[model samples]
Target chain A: MTTLMNRQYYLASRPAGAPDSSNVPARDVPVPEPADGEVVLKNLYISLDPAIRGWMGDDPNYIEPIALGDAVRSSVIGRVVKSDSPDFAEGDVAMTVGAWEAYTRVPGVMLNKLDEAAGIPLSTYLGVLGPTGLTAYFGLLDVGRPKAGDTVLVSAAAGAVGSVVGQIAKMQGCRVVGMAGTDDKCRWLEEDLGFDAVINYKQCGDYEAAIRVACPKGVDVYFDNVGGEIFDAALLCLNKFARVAVCGWISTYNVPDAPGPTNLWQLVAESVTVQGFTVIDYMDRFPEGIAQLAEWVVAGKLQFREEIVDGLDNILPTFLRLFDGSNQGKLVIRIPEE
Target chain B: MTTLMNRQYYLASRPAGAPDSSNVPARDVPVPEPADGEVVLKNLYISLDPAIRGWMGDDPNYIEPIALGDAVRSSVIGRVVKSDSPDFAEGDVAMTVGAWEAYTRVPGVMLNKLDEAAGIPLSTYLGVLGPTGLTAYFGLLDVGRPKAGDTVLVSAAAGAVGSVVGQIAKMQGCRVVGMAGTDDKCRWLEEDLGFDAVINYKQCGDYEAAIRVACPKGVDVYFDNVGGEIFDAALLCLNKFARVAVCGWISTYNVPDAPGPTNLWQLVAESVTVQGFTVIDYMDRFPEGIAQLAEWVVAGKLQFREEIVDGLDNILPTFLRLFDGSNQGKLVIRIPEE
Candidate 1:
């Protein structure tokens, strides 16, 4: 028996700077067949993250850049249509990269078979239980090295990575301060996530003053996802021997030129250490992170939130939400069944 | 019968910016008597380093500031006049932090007894076997860590510290390049000190081009003493995982407002590590450094140079040479007997 496939999204042209709807052209292509050691997956949910901006360019990074006119790269939860590999069979759910399309072929070694009958939602695998959660886990523990009673400051605190980072810091017995673009997100962090303090950066004209109030003792460990004025403000208020893990510079990726921080001299005065890292550096211990995140979710010690939009057509607009700070939590695209 | 005491110089007033002869008022002070565990020494030769600027300012540092109306602070080598302590007698030569004057009363604990009769000149103890040598030793070993055949670059190479640093890198089996302000200094470094290559930055309109010619394999370790445009150029040509040991920033110390580098993003791109350190941080390993340096000198593996200016009255002018690159090698002031 044959099955019909929906339209797939392929890369049309490489972007010079910020990517828009026109930069990524969508087209229909034949569904791929599962050869030996391969499985054909019908993508159900795709994860859109800020890291995609780096993949769009031909820069050197941990992951390979997707070539122009190739299918846009993403992580997706999908159901197997056919499996030529021994590890998977037809109708088995799998998690793999390149979930931006309706159907993708993944190798058996790379696919993680999931039990769809389980009570947990599918989008959770793309978020708190997947790459984002693992990033927050290793970045906070190995890089930042937060301790009990230490002050932890996280930028973009209400977003996917930041929200999880605050809760983990709180769980580790730290005084957490979350900086978000809106009052509602800040309020949610304080009220729902048990954060010690929250600052709506949009309302405050002086970010350093806001940080002074939010973090009275000064920041010990800073997980920097957004790198712009907030980064400079945080850098100014860092305590002696502070550790800054630069996971992503989402703030500068869109701009043609990157701006300089005027207060970089503060690093010398405080003996601060700043490091830029990608999640691939911690891939060896990814399972430990996923298991711990799962245990936290089941024990009610951690909460996961998602803003799911219907249809594959909405992926571009949903991805743009990351730059505008519109989404409260992890953003996902739920593809309709063909 | 009491003999006439030697004359000394006192701080007349703090300068707004660059120090001058008017800033130090020459005066005749009564030679101080040695108390218990103390030795009164007749100042023979004293090192006039750039660090004196830090002592003259009211800013906090590792050591105490020089107060107005008090004798200026410096590192000096002298002969003991009378010792109340068991460590030394009337004729023992010693090195202590007492430059700036004809006679200095130093605690015995702070004095390192020197043997002027040893085959080497007493002035060498103030250059290659003193704090300058220690700075170069630790800055290279602990910070730069140059590997065999690696390209090592030293700024202000003909100066006391840079000369030893480049020689040490050569001894470690690395390709050494020295950057000096004058053609004569560059010739001296290449001919006398065994540097693989030398660049006279004053003559070279394009330093990066000179660096490319001198260092065909690119710079792996950059020992930076002169900071400003020289530092900015080095940062651009640093290899991946390069180490920059910032021993001093002499270029910016005299300027009222120092301009920051525009190419700092290169640091992030190349994953370069820049560390600032002081000689005091390696007090425990001073003996090891001095021993190795002395052995190198005795074996003809290392050479020492001193630029001596006679009379304590010339201290201000001699000291000013460091800022203008007028003095070659270590600048020392030789005081006359009373």
Candidate 2:
């Protein structure tokens, strides 16, 4: 066989703020051979999530920060090219912790084998039926704890996790309200996703007023994705015993000095519980979550959008679309099979 | 009988910052007659708490803000001097939502009759066995949810609620660390209350460094009373899945523009739960809490301090002492009965 090569995007240095190409530079190296109980795969799809930005900084998180000179961590789906363990075979498709690279070599035990005959797109495993979907399901049902007749307010309501959260909350018999960055996104939430109300946050001059108008009963459960001024206003509009499920704060991820919520005192005023979590917090229950999410999708109850960028070269720029609110839904880079 | 007069400290105007004499001034008016369901009480002990300061502002709270031109709201143990309801008779002692006045007229149904004959100090009803103690009990046990071997950290450790929280957390088999303002207070928490470690925040040059040294195991539960720079620093030292029980942010109460805790991002970093509550939140279980606290005090297992100022006129100044950390433990005002 001719020499095989792998192109990877490796972290050159920790980012001070929003990462630049200099911080994550392209590197070309020969893909390593699979060790015992390891499998080598040609990665098919690379997931781009806002959480990736958080991992780039050397801050204490649910997981360790990506170390310097290592490939930036991500979740990817791929087809196995070589295997050294009976758990996997050549040509078997699977998914595992991966990076912005053409190939990945991982322990066979780490890979969750995917059925190519199942007729479901592999990219769906990286979006609505995967981490983002699990995040919304667990965060909303367990943390947000929306009761029937409760008003559920979700920020970034058009994005991957938030969209799934709003849909599941509606299924729980809640009055779901969404806040998205654009009128089009808001329209999608209201006209298509069956949201009770939608606030185009980009046009909503005063967050508190818009929230009050949209949720006249006051927010009983706030699914927080974008933290900052929006979060501050949501604090003021919380009902007594409100629950704030914080999954991410994409708005503040790039601003190192973002001011803290001025109205946090409302937590005491309303006897609120604000819990922060990552999907990994519910790792043991991901199987249950994925199965339930898949059922919802099959029943036509769950809808999602995935933006597929065609090449690894566009990964960094495509990932930045999450912060700018330019991406319509879950974003992924597909590396066409050679 | 000569017309009875009530000496009330009324809210003359809202304060811009720390309440002064002008914000709360004395007034002598004839005590009003009891309505059909009301009983007039000769106020004996008025509870002074930091929550009263929060009520002074027009901010939304567990209860309505003390109405402008009304006597400042508080809990008072008083003797029934006049009755229009059969539930209470003249000279019977009870506690109800009273104000900073020599006499309070309240609905008889709202009065919790005190068994002063039990030999416990009547003032104890407003301190250790009352709101402050109950706040510590439920906030720590329910919200903090400390597990055995957990490291529990408390701010304002010498204060009424914090002192109780640390003791209860110890009872639950957790290691307790306290932060106080003075060396004497720190010694009281350490030598007297059996705290595992004490940090005199006034002398500790760096809050995070002191906390790390004191809580070598990392903080699993943080009972926060004073919020400001101290709370921000404490957030940085939380362990994974830590719980922060926020009862009161006394440090920020008087500072209208007190910058919010900047390191709140740690909530996500450690999957923390920051829950805010008042003793009122546990209204249904107050009796259980009081009984447990009383048992602990009777068994000499629970200890508390109360600085009872001699007169109602001194209530404002004594309440301000809570902010300065000058008044030790639970603070109350005694209106010596005739």
Candidate 3:
């Protein structure tokens, strides 16, 4: 029997600040055969998320840290190359939490079958139609609970999760204002994504004032993906009984010593609720989120952008693009076809 | 009819940082007669709260800022000396949002009649059975939602609201850890209030380490009355899905430019919920809170302490005691009894 050599990125060392090549190193290893209820998958697409920075550190977080000398953790959409379980068969496309590798041997229970005939690209499952969509859907609807006519403000508006959040808020009759890093991203959000207003944080001198002008009635719901200065500005614009759904603090993920918002007391003055959540917390309700998001996509109401980086060897540099605000949308790595 | 002279404190100027005699001045004016639906009340007790500091500033808060040269707002227990309203006659003890004055003519609709014969002191109406109690009750039960065996950590645990919060969390079958400024206050919390652990933050070398030692299991519910370094420390000790009921940030009330918590991103890592609320938001459910608190007080299940300052002339210095942490328990001014 011939064995497959898998190309993978391993955690070399815990990062001091932003992760670099020294922290995550690439290597080639023989892919192990699946035993009993496990399956071997050939990863076609790997999700490059800001959260990967968090997994590089030893700090306690939503997910466990990737041990040194072990394969870096990631989410991937892959095709089953070999199966030893009744739940999965060869040639089946599956989405699962796996390592940053060309091929992964995972338990069958961990895999979710993906429909290849749905017409949507398999890469979309790693983005808007998958965990990202589910996060935006549940975080905004359940935690934020933006009512119609409410002013909804979202940070990192051009990003994968945040774009969906703004659109969903608009669908709920909310006046959506988004904050993006660059003028191009802001233009994309306002002109292409149907955002009512877009603030370029890079250009805005007074973020609070800019937010105030965009959200004339004050922010009723703030979907925060970037924490720090943006979070502080959003807190100042909170209306009475505002809700802040803290999905991710991508801006602070790399800077381990980043300062918190100075305007948190506004939560008390405005009777605000700031709740933090991850998509896995709503795992049991993924079907509901996927169904709703798929309907929106089918109806041409929800739009998504993917910035795909090719080859497994480029994984380390591709993941670094998240912190630099260079990635235009859902940043994904396309693993070379075996 | 001869008009009575009224002694009141009015806002002279907005304070830059902490309020003083220059910002809040005492004035003598004629006590006005009641109109058709108004009642003349002789203020017997004036509640000195940390919230008064916020009112001294021109910035917006839960309630309106006290206008310059206007009477400073406060919650007071007073005797209805005269009434033109159909609801009450003279000698009825009432609780109402009024001004820092010897006498006030308020609309009868704004006053909540207190049962003087219920055997609870009228001053207790300003503390444990009043807004302070209601703030703790609803803030903890409704917002914090602490379950049995949960570790509840409260800052300013020797203060009026914090003390009550600790007691209530204990009554609900949770482990409670309290942080207070003075060792005496810490002793009071553990010995008198049944707190599982008490940390003297002023004496503790490392606030987070002390908190971790006190709450080994981790903080499930954090009732934050104080914000600043203590708040930052508590954020570091939060457990997964912890709820933080931000009833007040008294520590930052006097400092206009106080720094926010540096570890707030722990909310995302731990999936925490931090909500801010005022007691007035729960006005509709005040009766329920009062009933429950009154029962606890009567059954000896709840205990409270009062640091009463006599005479209206001492109002400014007495109010200042709140920021300096000199006043113990519910600080109240015993207005000279006629």
Best by TM-score: 2
Give the CA lDDT, 0 to 100, for residue B175 in model 2: 98
What TM value does chain B of candidate 3 have? 0.98
* DockQ for each model: 0.20, 0.83, 0.79
Across residues B1-338, which tens digit of lDDT does each residue of candidate 2 receive?
55579999988888879999999999999987898789999999999999999999998887998899999999999999999989998989999999999999999999999997999999999988999899999999999999999999999999999999999999999999999999999999999999999999999999999999999989999999998898899999999999999898988988889887778778788899999988888999988998999999999999999988998878888889998999889999998875
Of candidates 2 and 1, the better by lDDT? 2
Q: In lDDT terms, which candidate is top?
A: 2
> What is the TM-score (0 to 1) of candidate 3?
0.96
Q: How does chain A of candidate 1 score by TM-score against the true chain A?
A: 0.96
Tens digit per residue, CA lDDT, model 1, A15-127: 77778767887888777677879988888999999988777877544566788888789999998888889999888898988657888888888999888898888899989
Q: What is the full ranking by DockQ, best candidate first?
A: 2, 3, 1
Deviation in angstroms for B314 in model 2? 1.3
Please give the C-alpha DockQ score of model 3: 0.79
Clashing pairs in 1: A74-A98
Which window of 10 residues has the lowest lDDT sum in candidate 2 chain A? A1-10
TM-score for candidate 1, residues paired by index: 0.79
True contacts kept of each: 0.02, 0.75, 0.81
* lDDT on C-alpha atoms for all candidate structures: 0.83, 0.93, 0.90
Clashes of each: 1, 0, 0
Ranking by lDDT: 2, 3, 1
Considering the two chains of model 3, state its CAPRI-style docking category.
medium
Give the per-residue lDDT of model 2 (tens digit) for A1-338.
44459899999998878898999999999987888899988999999999999999988888889999999899999999988879999899999999889999999999999999999999999999999999999999999999999999999999999999999999999999999999889889999999999999988899999999999999999999998999999999999999999998999999998888889999899999999998889999998999999999999999998899999999989989999999999999999986
